[model samples]
Target: MTTTVARVDVVAVASPKRRRRAPGWLAVVPLLAFVAVAFGIPALAMLDGAFTVRDQATGATSYSAENLSASLRGAYLTALLGSVKLSAVSAALGALVGLPLAQAVVTSRFRALREAVLTASGVLANFGGVPLAFAFVATLGNAGVLTRHLGLTDKGWDLYSFWGLVIVYLYFLIPLMVLTITPALDGLRTQWREAAQNNGATTVQYWLHVALPVLAPSLLGGLVLLFGSAFAAYATAAAMVGSSIPLVTLQIADALSGNVLVGQENVALALSLDMVLVAGLVMAVYLPLQRRSARWLA
Candidate 1:
C-alpha cells in the first residue's frame, strides 16, 4: 500500500480597510500640530490655572478645587444652568420648525426655488453675531418697525427676554438646521419610499416605520450642533442683553475683568473648564451619532 502525505499551509490576510499609508498619515501632521498649538496648549494652561491656587503672602502654590467649587454654587451655577436651558430650548425649537421646512424645500418640484432656498440658507447660517443682533433689534426691538406697525411692544414684547433670544437664535439656527440636514435629507433613497408604498404603507406609515428611524441619528446630530452653537455664543448675547441674562459666557467675561462672581471670587479658569466639559459632553454625544449617520448616508 502506498501512503501519500499532504501538507497544510496557513496564510494571514490583512484587510484593506485597516491598512494605513505613511504619506496619508504624514499629511495629517500639520493639522494635528495646529490643533495642539491652538487648542491643546491653551486648554492645558486653563486646566492648570483652574486647579492651582497661590498664596498671596507666601507665594506658595497648591492645587485646590476652590474655584471649581465656587463655580458650582450661586450666580455661576445659575449662569451654567441658564446656558444649558437656553441651548436645549432653542435647539429643540430650531429642529422642530426647521425639519419640516427643510423637508418641504427638498420635496418641492421647483429646482430654482430649492436652489434659491438653499443658497439663502447658506448665507443666513453664517449671518449672525453683532450684525444679526442689530438686525433683530431693528426689526423686533421695542421701537422696531414691525413692532410699531403691529403694536407688539404694547402687547408686552421684550426683545431682551429669554424667549426673545430664542426667537433671535431661530433666525439663524433654522437656516443652519436647513443647511445641516439638507444633505441627509437628500441621501434618503427615493426607492425606499417607493418600496414602502409597494408594501401598502401610507405616507404616515412610511415615515413612522422607515424614514424616521433612518433619520434619527442625523436629527440628533443636528440638535447637538445647534446646542453647541447656542452654548458657546457670547457676542450676540453680550451685545443684545449684556449681564441682564445670566449666561456662562457672560460670567466668564465678568470673571476675567475682576467683576467678581456673586461669591467674590474669579473663577474664569474654572468656568472655562466647565464650558469645556459641557462642550466635550456635547461632542461625546455628537461625534458617534454623526459617524453613525455618515455611515448610513454613505
Candidate 2:
C-alpha cells in the first residue's frame, strides 16, 4: 500500500487561452473622423490664415503676425472688449436670477413641477439665435404690442440699445444657468443638512457655511459656460441690432463677408483665433472647477 501510494501523483494545469476584448479605439474612429472633417480642417485653415499676409501689389502670400497685431488695435479691440463685457454682464445676471429659480425647483414637493421647470429650461436654453431675437423684437421693439400699449418708447426705452441686448441675452442665459445649476443643487446631501442642524446651525447658517462652499465650484463653472455662450453668440445680436452692437462676433462676420473690408479675410481668421483662445481660457478654468465639483458630488 505504501509503495503504490508513493508512485501516484496528480497535477492541474491552467488554460493558455485569454478572453477576447472588443477594440475600444475602433468605437471612437467615427467620432474622430467627424471631428477631423468638421472641426480640425477648418481650424487648421483658420490658423494658417491667421499667421499669413497677402501683398496688396504683387498678390504674394507670406507668413506674418500683422493680422494678430491688427486684431489688438482700434475697433477690433473695442469689439473684443465689448463682447467680454456683454458676456460678463449676462453671465452675472443669469447666475443671480437663475440660482433662486433652481433652488425653488429643486425644493419643490411636486414631481410634475420639477419636470416642467426642467423641460422649460431645456427648451429656453436652446431657444436662441434668430427666433429668439424675433420674439424679443416683436415683444419689445418699436411698434411692438407691449411698446404700443405701454408707451415704453415715450419713456426712452430703446429695444436695440446695449441694455436691451442684455435683456434679450438674459432670456436664454437664465435658463441655461437653471439647467446647469439644478444638478448641483440636487447633489446637496440631506446628511450634510441634517448634520448641520444637529450641530445647532440654522438653515441660513448651514447654507452659508456648508452648501455654498460646496456649490462655489459649480456656480463658477456655470458662469464660465454662460460667458462662453454669450461670447460666441452672433445670430440673435445680429438680427436684433445689426452691426450697431459692435461685438467681436459681428466684427468677424463683417471681415469674413467683406462687409467692412475686402482684403481682411486673414484678419477675420485672426479674430476667430482670438475667440477660440478666449473660449479655451474659459474652459481651462471651468474644467478644474468642474472636476472639483464632481469629486464632492460623487
Candidate 3:
C-alpha cells in the first residue's frame, strides 16, 4: 500500500553506430594511372620482346620458342648458374651471421650501443652497387690499402675473382640481414621471456620453445629478400669484374648494346630466362611463407 505506483516512462533511443559511405580513392587514381603508363607498360613490352624475334632487315618482331631454347647453352647458362650460386651462398651466409646480430640489438643492455650498432648496420645495408664496389676496390683490390701496407702490391689481391665477389656480397648482405631480422626479434613479447624465466626455463629452452617459432616467418621473408637482391644485382658485379665475369644482368646489358651481342633475338631470350628464374625463385619462397607471414604479423 505504501509503495507508490512507479511512473512508467519510455524514451526512444537511437543506435550508437554511424553508417559510413564507401571511401573514394579519387586522389590516388592519377598517380596509379601514371605508374601504369610509365612503368608497367614498358616492362611488359620488354618482356614480350624476349619471346619475340626481330627481323633486322624489316624491323619486325615475331614470337619464336626456338630462340629461347637456344639460349640455354653457352654464356647464358654459365652466367645464370653463376648468378644463382652467388646469390644462394650470399643469402645463406648473411642470414647465419645477421640473425645473431639482430638478437644482440633487440636484447642488449646498452641503449647507446644498440642505437650505434643499428645505425651503422643501416648505413652498410644501403651501401651497395657502385659505392660499395668502389669502397672495396680501394680497400681490398689489387694495390689497395691492405695490400699496399703489406707491400703485397706486386703479388696483389684480386677483387675481380669469384671469391672477391663473394666477399663484396657478404659485406653488403650481413648488414642487410641484421636490419631485416632485428625488427622480427623486436616484435617478440617481453612477457613471454619473463614467463619462461619464471617457469625455470633455460635460455636455450626459451629460444627453442618461444622465440624461434614466432620469428620463422620473418626469417624466411628476410632470406627471400636477400636472395632476390643478390640475384638481380648488376652494377656491383659489373664494377668489380667488368664483363669478364659472366652474369645474367651483364648478358642482358650485352644484348642491349650493339657492340657486344650480335643477336637481338638472343638477348630477348636471355632476358626472358632471367625473368622466369627470378619469378620462380620468388614464388618458391613466397608461396610457402605467405600464410606464415600473416600469422607472425598478427
Error of 3 at 295 (Å): 2.1
* Model 1 alpha-carbon drift over 4 Å, by segment: 1-26, 57-59, 261-266
- lDDT against the true structure, each candidate: 0.89, 0.92, 0.77
Candidate 2 C-alpha lDDT tens digits along 168-242: 999999999999999999999999999999999999999999999999999999999999999999999999999
Model 1 lDDT on a 0 to 1 scale: 0.89
* Stretches of model 3 off by over 4 angstroms after superposition: 1-23, 55-60, 150-157, 198-200, 259-262, 265-269, 287-291
| TM-scores for every candidate against the unseen true structure | 0.88, 0.92, 0.81
RMSD, one per candidate, in order? 5.7, 4.9, 6.9
In model 3, pairs of residues that clash are: none
Which order, best to worst by TM-score? 2, 1, 3
Q: Ranking under lDDT, best-scoring first?
A: 2, 1, 3
Which of the two candidates, 1 or 3, achieves a greater TM-score against the reference?
A: 1
Best by lDDT: 2
Best-fitting candidate, measured by TM-score? 2
The deviation in Å at residue 30 for candidate 1 is 2.3
Kindly report which residue pairs in candidate 1 clash with one another.
none
Q: Write one digit per residue (lDDT tens) for candidate 1, span 164-247.
A: 998988888899899888888998999999999999999999989988899999999999999999999888899898999999
Residue 289 Cα positional deviation in candidate 2, in Å, after optimal superposition: 0.8
Q: What is the lDDT of residue 21 in candidate 3?
A: 22
Q: What's the CA error at residue 6 for candidate 2, in Å?
A: 25
